[model samples]
Target chain A: GQQVQQSPASLVLQEGENAELQCNFSSTATQLQWFYQSPGGSLVSLLSNPSGTKHTGRLTSTTVTKERRSSLHISSSQTTDSGTYLCAPFNVGDNSKLIWGLGTSLVVNP
Target chain B: EAAVTQSPRNKVTVTGGNVTLSCRQTNSHNYMYWYRQDTGHGLRLIHYSYGAGNLQIGDVPDGYKATRTTQEDFFLLLELASPSQTSLYFCASSGTGVEQYFGPGTRLTVL
Candidate 1:
């Protein structure tokens, strides 16, 4: 089974500090997406960077298909950014299913 | 905004009881998915459908059955719920390979 692994199960950062979350997959992915889940809330799509680099506002996602890995970079994080960042990979081998990572619980403190 | 709505945000069922969770999407997306979230398992896909009347088993499909009778509706069925089925369930929809818009989620507890 192709697994999506997220680094640093949990992270605590001061407000305005930068945060970096890593995601690695075991198989080649045709689609990759980053999702943010607030405390006891539903998941929200943060960015969809299947390949290459993409930036939206203060969040940037870089996916290197050759390496089968991706990273989510948050610049000048805010308290509202305190949530769980999830990585999901689609199209694992013959199966076209999304494999999700456990997620990185990030806390941006003031 | 893409709207994905789930009914009965919270549910409590006794062990061996039957349970059903409903989901509706107005975005007219072709793909719909059902997943469970737990402390250990972040999110495990239980089932998905490409369109109305089409069902596909996901990685964690055991003990669960799903039905997609209409393009706007998808349902998850638990014939004999167990304690292990207690978790937060999420419904999502997407078009092509883009990002999936998820519902508020349903917290189900099988006591």
Candidate 2:
């Protein structure tokens, strides 16, 4: 069974601070995606990066396929960004399936 | 925007009761998936389909059955619901790429 491990299960930061989340997979992955799950449990795809750095607004995702790891960086965190961040990596052989991480719970305080 | 919509945002059922969760995707994507989210388990895949009439077993498909009647519709069936099956279920659709668009999610409670 393939596994995706997320580090710093939970994070707390000031509104203006930055947050870094790490995801390490047990097996090789062809693509990596980051999602933001609101407090209401709705998920929204943030970015999809296979091997390089990708930026969208204040969020940046960097995936190193060779290292089997990915990182999501959020700059100038805000209170609205308080939610769970999930990392899902597509399985190497099966592109239809994604191995999901336990998610990094982030709480940005004012 | 890729839209994935799910039905009956919330459900409650007794043990052994049959429950069906519906999903519709307007992205015209070829892949659809059903997953359950728990407190510590994150998101666990229950079933998936590459296209209409194609069913693929996911990691956690024991207590669930799924059907893809059309390219825009997919359903997950819980023939005999149990308390342990209570969780937030999400339906997602993706195309040839790796980005999966998720629905608002359905919260199911079995007593």
Clashes of each: 0, 0
User: In candidate 1, which residue pairs get closer than 3 Å at backbone N, Cα or C atoms, i.e. clash?
Assistant: none
Task: Return the TM-score for chain B, candidate 1.
Answer: 0.98
Tally clashes: model 2. Answer: 0
Give per-model CA RMSD. 1.1, 1.1
lDDT of 1 by residue, A12-38 (tens): 999999999999999888889899999
Which candidate's DockQ is highest? 2
TM-score of 2: 0.97
Off by over 4 Å in 1: A92-94
Summing lDDT over every window of 10 consecutive residues in candidate 1 chain A, give the lowest-scoring window: A90-99
- Candidate 2 stretches with Cα past 4 Å from truth are none
Question: How big is the positional error of residue A19 in model 2, measured in Å on the Cα after superposition?
Answer: 0.7
Candidate 2: tens digits of C-alpha lDDT, residues B1-111: 889999999999999999999999999999999999999999999999999999999989999999999999999999999999999999999886378889999999999
